[model samples]
Every structure is written in C-alpha cells, then in structure tokens.
Target: MLQSTTGIERLVLVPSLLRSLLMYLQLQKRKDALACLKLWVCSGETLVVSLAKEFYNYFPENEYKLCNFYGSTEIMGDVTYHVITGMDQLRHQDKVPIGLPIDNTIIYILDSNYRPVKTGEIGELFAAGQNVAAGYVNGRDPEKFVENSLAIDPMFAKLYRTGDFAKLEKGTIFYEGRTDSQIKIRGHRVDLAEIEKAVTSIDGIGKAIVLCYQPGEINQALLAFVLTETNITEHQIEEALRQKLTSYMVPQVIILDSIPLLVNGKIDRQSLLKAYGNVNNNDISFQNGIDYKGVPKDQMHAAIALFETIASVLGKAARSTISIDANFYNIGGNSLNSIFTITALSDRGYHINISDFITAKDLGHILSKLSNDRKNAYLSGQTEHDYTSELLKDEYKEDVLDMITTSFYEKADLEQWLMPNIYVEDYRELIDAIWEPLVDKRLSLVVRAKNGEIHGVALNFDARDEPEVEIKSQLNIVFEFLESIEGPVRDNILPPGKGTVLHSFMMATRSTLTPGENVSIMNFMEDEVLKLAIERQFAGIFTTNTSPLTQQLGSDVYAYETIHDCQVNLYVASDNTKPFAKAPDSQRAKVQWKPV
Candidate 1:
C-alpha cells in the first residue's frame, strides 16, 4: 500500500509481488481473473454516504469517478455506466446525479402497486438493460424484485425491480432511501438519511453517525456519535444543533471523538455511546416566564416538552429522547420551513438566524470556533452580497424609504397609462377574455388603446393551485414581488387583514421589458397595473413594477409587503441576459406604451 495525505491509496498493488508469486503458483501463466470494471451500483439514497467516501478514496486522485449504470437488472448485467463531473456540488447534499439517460437503458421508478406516481414523484427504481441479471439466486423474494405486469409499454418486456426509492425533479432522478430503511413517524415515512444529513450539516463536527437505539425497553430514540476536534464543548454542541435539527431527530446522547470508525473500517457506534456519559449532563430548557433558568431539567419536563414541540414541527414521531443542539433542517425542515420556525421563535421573543445553528448547535465542541454570536438575531435574510452588497439589520429602514420614493410611478392620465401600445384585434380579444368573467363579478377591466390597440393588461381572480396553464404557476413570486412593492395594496387584498391563505398555480404575463429595462418596468407595474388589480378587487396583484401602465401612475399609488424568489421548474438564466427580440417586439418594451 502507498502512503498519502488524504487517506491510504493503492491497497492492492498486484504487479511486482505477482511477478515473484508467479514462481509458486500454477496460475501465474494466466493473467488475473477476468472481472468487468463496470460501476455495479450508483450510490442511491439507500446507500450510505460512507460508501461514496470509500469509492472516492480508493481510486487515484484523477482516476476515481462516479458512473451511471443503466438498464433493468432483468435484461442485462447493469448495461451502462456514464461518468461525469459536478458531483462535488452534491457530495454534501442529496444523491449525486451522474447525468441523463444512457444508451439502451430505460430507467423508471414505480410505486408499491406498480403504477407510475407522476413524472417527477418518488417511486421504486427499476432498470431495463441488455446485461441485467436474469433473476435472483436461491428462492429470493420474487415480489421484491419482480414485476408481474411488465411496466414499460410497447416493449412489454418483463422488468426486474432494483427496489430503490427515488424521485425525479427537473427531469433528474434523485434517489431516496429504501422502503426498509424508511421509518414511519406520525403517518409519514421518514428517510433516516435525511436526519443524518441534517446532523452533519452542523459545522465543526467532522463525522456524524446516527443509530436507531432501542434497548427492548423504552421507546426508540436516536443515538448520534460525532467525530470532531478537541476543543468542542458539550454545551455548544447541543446549542449548535438546535438551530438546524428539530426535536425528534436529535439524538438522545452525543458522543464526541477525534475519529469515528473502528479498525475494521465500520462505524464504532458502541464506543461513542459509552463515552457520552462523561460529558455535561445538564439539560437546557426554554421555559416560558422562567427567563434563562439555570436549574436542571431533572426537576422540570419543560425541555422535553419543547423538544416534542420542535419534533411536531418537523413531523417526526415522538422520540423517547433528543439532544438539545440538534439542527431543525437535517430533520426535514427545509430552508423554507426553517424561516417559519424563526418566525415562531421571534414570536416567542427570540430572533435566530438559522445559519447560526451551524456553529451554535455544535454540542459545545465547535461553538468556540464560531466568529459571531449565534443567538437571538433578526435579519431580513436577503444577503448584502445578494443585492445591496452588505448584510444589514433586520430592516433596511433608510434605503427602503429611498427605494419606495424612486420606485413610484405617478400616472395622472389613467386611461392612456392603462394601454400604451397594442393592435385593436388583440386588445379586443383580451377585453373579451376578462370582460365576460367580470360580468358575473362587480368590476371589469376596461380595455383602451391609441388606435384600438391593446396597450397593457390587468385581471383579477380568486387564488388557487389549479389549472396548469397561463400565469397560475407564478402566483407566489408575483404575489411576493407585489407585497415587497406595495404593503397597503397587499393588505387591501386580504380581508380583515388576516386568515386569507393562498398559493398560486396560475398567472400569466406578456412583456417586452429587456433585462436592462426590468428595474424601470418594475416601478411602472407597481405604480399602475397592480394598483388597478387591487382597485378591481384582486386579493393580490402580480405585474412587473415598471410597465408603461404602472409608470403613468405615481409611486405613492403602490405599497408592498414582501418579495422573494418563487422556486419553480424552469431554466431561469443566472445572468439577467435578455432574450433576443425583433424590432416590433422591442417597441413593446418601451415604458411609454399603455395597456388597453
């Protein structure tokens, strides 16, 4: 074996030694046994992360790689293995996607009843390839690997199942855990890897291993063994995790060490748990009205209650025990819901940046390495580097005022501002589409144009996630953008300023705004079209802030509440590079045209 910095390399060097051994062995005349070096398994969610590390470390620095093996096990012996880069980005996140479909491979994931769930939903992965193994050995459970009805149509060939759970997002199949590894908590099957992922996301801990600990006595609680640096303290470790993990997924005990694996190369779950007793056993509680009570939790069950509360938020089964520092994120609280948790905490008189959980939740071990305080904090979340080039306080009070003033579009000539440039036929079509719907309602969009051309457009409707056409898909972004641009208008949409719940599945916009003209157009939309939607009884309005119609109106006519990215399936360019536009289409971008 050769020595190395990253880890041991070339554990089996079969060259010069084989030359000498040739003298003793009869098989020396023959080369080594023929073995196909094809990728046998693409690491699935059922596969542990340690296996990935092993494969990576086993090969030479530039030689090791991730390959995609395609085709069903029934047809062929794992027909294809396509290698690719960009796996480093996903190494610490979810499953690594090797790439697209390979030659002669039909990979599909199916449900228990063997029906396709959806285009991108999670299912049991099955392969159909030329070299897949014909069948399993020695009375193996047939149903687990067999499909009676031959799923892929037209081909009609019987396919063997891989039994791996996976989901497709944006056309990329992502592996989930095996159904066997999945644990049901409160009617939801939980992926244990997801919990482990959250635990590892905590900074300062080098390695984290979670074990299902049930001593055949009390309820099941997770036991986490962490490998970290020497300076980490127990207290800091507990707190660091609190930011990222919810309650139930947190381990009952955390054992810290410099190394996590045993000599046999397997995780030493037993050794870590044995060492956990020595660390500080004091429980930290967030009891109401107690104000940082230093008293131990042995006398009070408040900490356990809080733990249960956090677990409920994460939808985890009520665990028997949990560590105080467990991060909420790793336990299935995504960035979106983590923000909700922060809101909940804020209402309880504590403001926390979920990022602080990185260091603060380090079980007192890694908290010392933190450069900044990871406690009660309030932030707008939009990074300074993201927009204004600096992270600010919870509110950007001064700049917000200036932004509002600059964003205003005053349109004293309302009708001319409504429709800037449009042909009469198209304007009439748009009018007919809205005018009929409004006949049953109170108000309607009155279309107008210079020569009967449609200048701009506006509409109103009750919110819903139905009908996959038009602008319903962008309802979230449009609403958030409107809220950020106009608060009073947003409030006007919500009856009694409360209890109006909504998610948009439809919305549409036809715009000529170039990338350079986007900001200007936003000001106009906030000032004009959106205002018209609210005046006409829209619960929320969505239109660019700088449309010709909006520019005609002044800034004071708009007020917003919040604005953020609406994550969706689309190829949104990283750079705001405007698509090429013909001259006729380019004129539509000018802020002077009004919508009829």
Candidate 2:
C-alpha cells in the first residue's frame, strides 16, 4: 500500500520502529515506494536497534538517514535529536539512544539523592529548557516540577522531573524504563523496558509489551506479550531471556497477533490487565500434571519430539500440526510452559541444556545440537571434578574449630569492625554447639588441598527451626541495627522473618600459596552453598562472617544485601529483596461515594 506514495521525500512523523521497518521493507522490494522518503524523523518511544537494522538493510544507506528525537509533552516536543547514519546505527546495535540534549535544554540524570550519577548508571531524567512548561493549570506538581537548586546557572533554576529512568553513555542518554513501570518479581528489580528490548532483539519478534502479573507483592510474576512471525516456544524465548536477564527478570512469553492499542495508538495497558488479570501466570505451563507413557528410542529424535510437544501444548494445537523447521515461539511456545517441556524431557532421561535450545535455529537444529554436545562430552572424556565433599567428621571437629578461630584471630586486626571479639567467640561457640547436630543432618563440607592440608570449610544448613538464647540475642542486635537505620535505608533492608533461612556459620579458608588457589576454594564452597540452598529451597541465605571475597561474590552472583552495624557486617542473600518505600497512604487521593 505504501509502495505508491510518490514524491514523499521527507518522512517526519512518529511511526513505531516495527511499523517503519515493515513499510521500508515493502518499499525497498518495489524500488519505487520509499525512494523519495529520505531523512526519516522519528519520535515517541525509544527505537530498538534490531528495527533500525531492518531499515538500513532494506533502504540505501546513502539515500535515507534516520533521526531519533526525544522529548515529553510537558517540554513540547523534539527537545533532543540524534541523526542515525550507517555509523550511528552500527555503533548502537543494541539500542538507539535519545542522544544529547538540545541547545537550550539542560538535562540531569540524578539518582534518588538528587545527585548526578556516573556514566551508564540509571537515574531519573530531569529537563530544564525553554520549552518546559511553567506549571500545571491548577497548580504545579511539587514532585515533578522542582526548583533546580543544583543548577550552576541561576536563570534556569526550575527543572521538571520526567519520572523516566535513563542511563547516560558517552554524552548519549539511553532510556532504561519508566520509574512507575519498574516492578519487583521474586524480590529482584525488573525493568520492563529492558525486557522489551531483549524481546525485540529476537530475529522474528516485532514488538513486546511486558507487564507485572501482580504489583507490589512477593508472588508477583512477569507476563510478556510478543508479536512475531517465527515459530518460537515459550521455553526457547525463556532460554534466550535467561542469557540477557536474571532468572527473576525473565517474563512468561505470550504470543499475540497484535497488541491492544488505544485510540491514541499507544499500548492499552489497562485493557490488557483487565483481560489477563485473573489468570495465574505461575500455573500457565501446559505440562502441569500431564501423564506420558512412551519415550522415543533415538536421543536426537526424543529431543525434537519434546520441543514439538511443548509447542503443541503452548499453541493449543495437535503435535502433527507442528513442523520440524518451525520455531517454538512461532508455534505458541512461551516461557511459562517451557519449564514443563524441559521437565518432561528430563523425566524421559533426555537432559537438554536450556542454553543450547535458546540459540537453536530450529527444532531439528536444537535436537542435533543436543546430540552433538552429548557426543562431544563423551568423546572428549569430560568428567565432573574429583573434589571431595562430605559432612563434618567427628575426628576433624577440633581441626575445623581451630581453623575458623585462627583465621578470625589473624584477620581481626584488618577487619576488627566486622570481626568483633564478641561475635568471633560467639561464632566459635555456635559452631562447637552445632557440630554434632550438623553432622547428623550432613550439613558441612571440609575440603583439603593437594598436599593433604585442610584448605577450606563451609557450614550451611537451615537453622531457623530452632533458635536458642544466644542465637536470639545475636539476631536481636542485628535487628536493632536495621531499626536504627531510619528513613529509606531501613525500608530497603531485608525484613526480619522466619521462612527456611540457610545460615553459613563459618566459611573459612586456610592460608594458600597463591591467591588464585584461595579464590578457587572460595568458589567451590560458594557452589556448595548454592547447591544446598537449591536442594532445600531456602528462601534466604546469610553469612555471619564477611570477607572481601564473600562480599564481592554476594553482590555479583546472589544479590546479597549487606547490613553494616554493631561492629559486625551481616550479609543477607534474600535475592536482593527490598520492600518498596511507598508514600503515606493518607496522602493519596480518595474518592467517596455520595448518595444519588
């Protein structure tokens, strides 16, 4: 339809990245239709890089130039502009940023402290420009429109907070996500915009809309509606998402023919919520409570068959309808039901790695890849590490106690604040008291070096069920410090509660010849702790002692929240879970029903 648009030289409008790419693709095929369209000016939402590539591929690079503009309704429009040439498009292949601020506009990316954030750090975007409106009609929103006291120029003292999260990279500002749209799932902070970016990055995916199944709750799950022509399963999409995002950040993919849009052409989020509001996303899997009788003889065939079954389940179609080349995503596969497919395959003794499945070209390709990986592992004589892992033995009890006490005493001078004398002695006593019980429950690991010397020891077990006077006192002191943290910090700390807490009593490492050996031992112990947590389904994990290695490990892998007080550093790994500090309920607007 757009192929006949003659003499349309400059396309200056707000067309979605997907829509624009489609038009360009159709026009490029005819060689007449978008030929006149040069200097494509786009603004409205941030453009995804994949969509930009389509434009560059379909249209002549020298002829057509893409411009990305950024602005808000309050700031009129087109405050900042970024000309996307071949170089700019290639440079920002992941995301096409909003570029620099306009000539007269003063922009600031400030954190919650209202201080400028480092480059690439996400912060609230503020704009102070001539186009910025003075105030609302009735009265200015104090939160949105604030006096820019930090401004160097006294003339531009007023700045409007856009409530949009953005990251500045080399003078270019990339939209992260909206502050109000960001939500917590499984205690992890999830940016819907980040998810949308990942979704649109997929080869066949056109657009994505991610939403929180439930807001402001622990059981909250993420749901994603994706528009794509490729046959992709939920699990396959999930596997891809897992590579880009954390486990909690991966949303349940739902294939939609088209996104529900309002009259204004914006996504109708309210209508979407109303439709899927009551559906329990956690139980959206198709393999839930299904009984299977037979397994395929060929391993490769079995893997492909599993994917086909998963596609059928998610797409609500018969297995015969699915083709070998069809991707799971195009066939109604979603992340919510991918787990079931994997589980079903695992049940049949075919252990397929999710990572391989995510990047597979097609169903047959995934099965062949899985088969090849297994053959390669077998042919290469690959085997698990021969490291000894066992419960704390009665004979080594004294040795274990001495190792921990000696390490603490030695490191006390350096970390006196963290390794207080009282806490050290308390830890020793606690370990001594629980040694026998822990041995009975098989809850400790003592690793030895190649020279037969004790290298490291880690004690991880659920200790929430029974709490003695000493333990209770220690917890009370920790809780007291948390309480002392008045204001925002207090709210961000993990709340005190009891729900299967795994305590790492003493993770001590003996002096090694090299720092690399020490790191290896530490990593091995961390793996053990993670295994225990996964096996026992621990809601939270804690380390009584803190070291540089453990602290970095916590922040890097498990998202541990550290509490610094009482001359002791307690590290809590609750999936970096923090309660949202909400405004006072009384301050919210209220509407009362009056008699008609």
Candidate 3:
C-alpha cells in the first residue's frame, strides 16, 4: 500500500474532479470526502463562479479555500490563481478572474500591434516566464513562440503568445475570449467565445458554445449550442444577452443535453456543426422520445395539431413518438426545422412565428397562447392602399401619424434620445413631408380593425426624393455600405437606380397581441411590399435602423443584406432555396465589364 507522511492541506484538481467528489458525497458513500483539505485549487476549464458556495451548500461540515488557477497546456498548468469567497462576489459576472500571476511568471495583455493595452481592455495574452514551454517539439508554427525584444534576461528566449483574449483589472487577469474564435458575420466581426461567456453567466446554463456554421458559399449561420441545467426560455436567454451585448452579437441559443467533446476533452466543433445540420440524429434528442410515447391521448386539438406540425418538420421518425407536451428542442427541432414548421403551419392556415415557437414551454402552452391571440387579434377590417391614387388620404392620415408617433416615441424612450419639445402636429408635419413624394408609388398600405381604427401601416418611398437632409444622408450611407460588401448577392442588393426604402412599419396591436400575431402582421406587410417591388422592379427594398428585430421580423425567406454599423438591411425577394440565383453566373463576367 502507498503511504505518505505529509498531511495534505492544499488540493489541486480540475472542476470535473471536484464534481466527482461531490457526486460521491451525494451517494452517501463518502460523507467526509476531502475533509482533510484546507485549500482546493481548481484548473482546466473556467471554474464555475459559484463552485465554492455550492460545495458548502452540499457539505456544510467541510470548509476550504477554493482557488481557480488559470493557464494553458503550453504554460505547464497555471500562471495565475484566484481564491473564491462567496457567490456574492460573482453575481452578474461570468467567471472568477485568473488573478495575479504566480511566482516567476509575468503576464501581459497586448493589442494586435504587440503594445500593452489599457487595463480592462480585452487583448491577446502573452506570457514571459521560466515556466513557459520551450517551444513545441518537431518545430511547430513559429508565430506562437516568437521572441519579444523588450523582454528581460531569464525569459528572453521566447514569449508565448497564447491566442487567448483577456483583460487586466486591479492586478487581476480576466479571460474575455479567444483570437481564433472570432467570426465575420454579415460584415461584423463577432467573437464566439464572448457569447459563450455571456451565456454561462446566466443562472441555469451549465455550459455554452457559440459555433459558426458555413454550409456553402452564401449561407453562414451562427448558433449557440448550450448545456442547460434548468428549463429556460429562448427569449429569456436573448433578453439577457440583449442587456449585455449588441443586437448583432446575439446568436440563436439552442439548449442541448450535453456539449459534445473530443476524446481529449476539448470541444468538438465539427461535431457541433454536424449536429446543427442534422439536429434529429444527435445525442441531444429527447430521450429518444420514450417519454413522449407515453403522453395522454386526450390533449387539446390545437396542441395535437402543433405537435403534428413539429413532428412532420422533424421528419418521419418523429411523427409517431412526438407527444403533445414534448418540447420542440428535445424532439429534434432546430432553427431550420422551426422555419419549415412555421411555414408549413402557415400553409395549413395556422399563422405563427419562430420567436413564438422557441419561447413557449411546450406544445400545450404554445397552443393555448396561439388560441387566445387569434381570438383577440382577429382581422376585422382592411383598406389596401392603391398607390396609383393618393397613397396617404386625409381621412387615414391622423391614425397613420399616430401609429408613427407612438412607435417612434417608444423607440426614443428606449434609446433615451433627448429631443426638442415635439407635439402631434410636429409628427404629422414630418409624416406629411415624406408622404407627399409617394404621389404615384404603389408601395404604401394600411390595415384597420372593424372599429375603423388603424391597426397596421407599411410605408415605402423613393429615398432619392426624401426632403430631409438627415434622411438623404442616411440613405446615401446605406447605399455605399451595400456597395462595399463583396459577395454574389451584392449586385442584387446594390441600389439599382433610386433606392426604395421601407422606412416605417408598425402594428397598433404590437403592444396587445402575442409575438405570433405581430409576426403575422409583419409577414403580411412585407409580402404586400415585396409584391409591389417585384411588380415595379424597384432598385432594392431596404430599411435603415439600429434594431435587429426589424430585419428578423421582416426578412422572412428573403435574401437579406446588412451593413452592421449603419444598421441598413436590404431584403431582396427570391426563391428561398437559392437566394442569390439572380446574381451573375460567374465572377469573371462582372470583372469583365470593369475597365482595367
């Protein structure tokens, strides 16, 4: 038997090790597991910020210092250490900082130019110390082991550039993201690791991976695959991200049973992309639908229909097993499946939205909400505007102006925009200024309820004729932005001659109706506008806005183009299967036209 005379006070382990010890205690086999330890040091993956509190919560008799060590495999385990105290220290935070550098190790947070970045600014982490590995065996990439001329003697031979994004604050080193983990989505540089950190900060998310799936030439999708411990709605996750990140930074979050890992314990990114495509055939499937098979038969008719719609979208295998209560996420549903399901249901005369499907708890809840919304928001009246005549009539002008004012005022409130004192007449004047130019354009429409109250309005006009200088400048910037992004769809998106912009759209029922109903209104409005654009062969249908919801709700099955900072998104109508089918057959043909 092995024996040691040393009484262990400090315990160094990975998070998995500590979890295993806790599991043993839960089984009642080892109530005093690791009771002799005074300090428990954790390394390897980011230590859960609340691990210290959790340990005490489960085993009140045991008390120990829980330290989270941070470093990479190339740096021989740890470079910094942070001793955690309580959950209060981590409230609203992602993870504990790696803390100050260990003895004999020096860490530098530097920008891309290799200059020291300001404290609290995210930058690549570089290590200069005796503990840093002496370069990879067999001569690997030299970029990682480059020598820094500014380094002092003992550590002069090499300065390891760890690719890890981090920031230093008050002598503590906090991990931010990874340099290699950045992705360019719709011309915006997105850091996937940042998303993962944000997701893990949420209460119930066990782990998360932000993955980019580039299926082919044009379709690039960013999806968040997460391991959640408790039931959470997608909207809740989205709302949390909305508070911490820009709208463009929020990726679609998909809950999973577990994160797929490689044999060596690192994330299997390829597997995640594969599962994203074939969501039905993954390890995350709803317990193979065994629980679903046992559901009661007397569920509501709407619930049955919703379940069938989900099952049909998931494919043939799911039709028999997916119960009325089965979650779309657990039963092989994904974003792609969701789009198809909603489209199919719409064809079946059941209007719904992707947001509605993802936010609901289950089929029963969604059906109940859907039933209620339809009864309350039923379309009672309609006045389709004929652009050939006066588009904005005197009778409808007040209600239209009211819708615009209310919507814009709400936006102003949310953004905290300080504007000059403005009344209803001021709003009416601006609306009139934009409305006069649409004298003969068939691109404006309004829908009203039976009470002769306007419930919806869609306004589109030639930006070239806009009277306001601010509006013209914005449209000019949007045109330039679209022309800048090079892709097969660029030609189709570039303003042909004069740009036709859909500047304003809002449903009065937006405040009262469910997301599904609002989406229905949006879809109707977009369809009407797109038909007008197609009939006229207008340059491009675009909207200038900062909100991502505008594009998400409007660009259904359409080829979408966006210029990130400008908040200009152009939606071009085409076959969903081949969004850029109208583009030139070959790049050579376009370059051939250019004068050399």
- lDDT, candidate 3, 1-596, per-residue tens: 12222587787776755765664566665545555666788887767665555676665322556788888878887888887655555666656788888888888888756789998888889988888887888878777987776676755456899888889887788987677776544334467877777877788876677887662122345677876767887658867887887554667677777666667556678998887667554433222343434334553555556665665555422322465466665444433345566556655656544445556567665554453343232231123422121244557777677666665543321111112123345556556666655434545777654455556677766534444423332223323333343332324644444643333323332333333334445555655666666666664565543333443333333334443332112323222232223223321111001000
Looking at candidate 3, the ten consecutive residues that score lowest on lDDT are 587-596
Better of 1 and 3 by lDDT: 3
* lDDT, residue 534, candidate 2: 64
* Top-TM-score candidate index: 2
Write the candidate numbers in order of decreasing lDDT: 2, 3, 1
What would the TM-score be for candidate 2 when compared with the true structure?
0.51
What C-alpha RMSD separates each model from the true structure? 19.3, 15.3, 12.2
TM-score of each: 0.35, 0.51, 0.48
Evaluated against the true structure, the overall lDDT of model 3 is 0.56
What is the C-alpha local distance difference test score of each model? 0.38, 0.58, 0.56
Off-target runs (Cα >4 Å) in candidate 2 are 3-8, 15-28, 137-140, 152-155, 278-596
Q: Candidate 3's error at 322, in angstroms?
A: 17
